[model samples]
Target: MKEKNLLKDSSAYYENNDYYEIFSKAEDGESKVVNYLSKIAKDKIVLDAGCGTGKFLQILEDVSSKYIGIDLSFNQLVKAKIKSRKENSIFVNTNLKDTMLCSDSIDLIVSPWVLGTITDLGDRELCLQDLKRVLKPGGKIILIENEEDSEFETLRGHDKDTRTKDYNNWILNNGFKVMERFNTYFKFDSKDEARKCFLEIYGVEVASRVKSELIEHKIVLFEFVK
Candidate 1:
C-alpha cells in the first residue's frame, strides 16, 4: 500500500485492530523502561513519543513526576485517552517528527517501535532533531525496535520492519550512545487473536503458520544517552 493509503487507513486500523494492543502487552521495554526510570524520573517529566494508545502512560502516571504522550493518529489518541485516567498524564494528537514542546523540557523520552513506521529518512532525521531539542541535559532515550522483519508486514511487502538498516547508524551519526540493549519476544494472548489479526494483515498462509508454529516475534530494545 502507498503512503497516502497508509495515512488514511491508520486511524481506522488502530481503532479497530489488535495490532497495538496485543503487541504492547508483549513488549518488554514497556515495563522494563519504566522500571529503570522509576528511581531517576521520580521527580522528572517524561515524554512518550509516538505513544500509540498510551497503554504505558497509565503506568507512568504512578511513577514519573509528569507524563505526556503524543501520536499522529487521532483514533489512537482517542483510545489512549480512554485508557488513560488523565491524572498527571496528558495525551495529545500530534506527530513525533515535530512535537510542539518546549526546549529542554523532558527528562526522558521513550519511543518504542516507532522508526520503522516512519520509513522516510528525512522525516526520521527531523524527529531525531526534535528529540534532541526537547531533551534536558543528562536525559536518556529508550527505544524498542525490531531486530528483524515483521513477518506479517514482510508478507504484505510493507515497510514496517526495522533495524536491518537505519536506526543504529542514525544513533551513531547523531552522537548518541546506546547504553544498553535487550532482546525479547512479542507474544500474543492466544493463537486465536494472532490468527485473526495475522489473517487480516498477512493472509492465510502466514496466519496458518503462526497458528501451527506458535511463533513469537523478536524485538530489540535500546537505551540511549546524549
Candidate 2:
C-alpha cells in the first residue's frame, strides 16, 4: 500500500485495543528505546505525546516526577490507564496538533513514532508547535522514528512517508538533530507468532517475508531543545 494511505488504514487496528496490544508488545522487544528515554526523564515532568496503550508509561512513570500521556484514541487511553500503576500518571484524550496542556509546563516530551504518521507538513508542524508550547525553557524533545533501508521499510512495502529522505531532511529543517541510529529487532517467540502479528498489522505480502523469529529493524532518535 502507498504510505499516504497507511495512516487511514491504521485506525482500524488502533481501535481494536486487544489486537493493538499484540503489535505493541512485539515492538522494540529489547526495550532499548524505552531505556534511553527513561534516563533523561529522571526527576522531570514528562509528557508522552501519542502514548498508545502506555507502552513507555511504566518506565517513564518510575523515573519522572510526573507523567502525562496524551492521545486522540479513547480506547488506547483506556488501555493505557490500565497499564499505568502510579499515581503520577495522567492520560488525556486529545489531538496532538492542539492539546489542553499549559504553556511551558512540561520538562520533557517523548514522542515515539507519532509525528511521522501525519502525512501533512502543516499538521506535523502544528503538533511540534504545541509540544514546544508546553515545554519549559531549555526543555527537551525526543522523537523515535523508523529509519530507511531496514527490515521495517521492507516489510511496510512503501517509502513515501516519514521514512523517506525527504522526511529526514524535513526533521533536520525543523531543528531536530540526530542523536543516534541503532539496530533493534522484533523478537518473537516463534515464526508463527511473528507471521501472525505481521499479518495482522502489515498484511499477507509483509507476513510472507517473515522467515525467522527475529526481524531486524532500524530506528533513529532525534533530539530538540526548547
- For every model shown, what is its TM-score relative to the native structure? 0.77, 0.92
**How does residue 92 of candidate 1 score in lDDT?**
77
lDDT winner: 2
Candidate 2 lDDT over 71-170, as tens digits, reads 8888888888998888767888988889979999999999987887777778889999999899999999998887887877777764545456677778
Residue ranges of candidate 2 with Cα displaced over 4 Å: 1-4, 9-13, 159-163
Best by TM-score: 2
**Cα lDDT listed for each candidate:** 0.65, 0.82
Error of 2 at 55 (Å): 1.2
Worst 10 residues of 2 by lDDT: 2-11
User: After aligning candidate 2 to the native by TM-score, how far in Å is the CA of 16 from where it should be?
Assistant: 2.8
Steric clash count of candidate 1 = 0
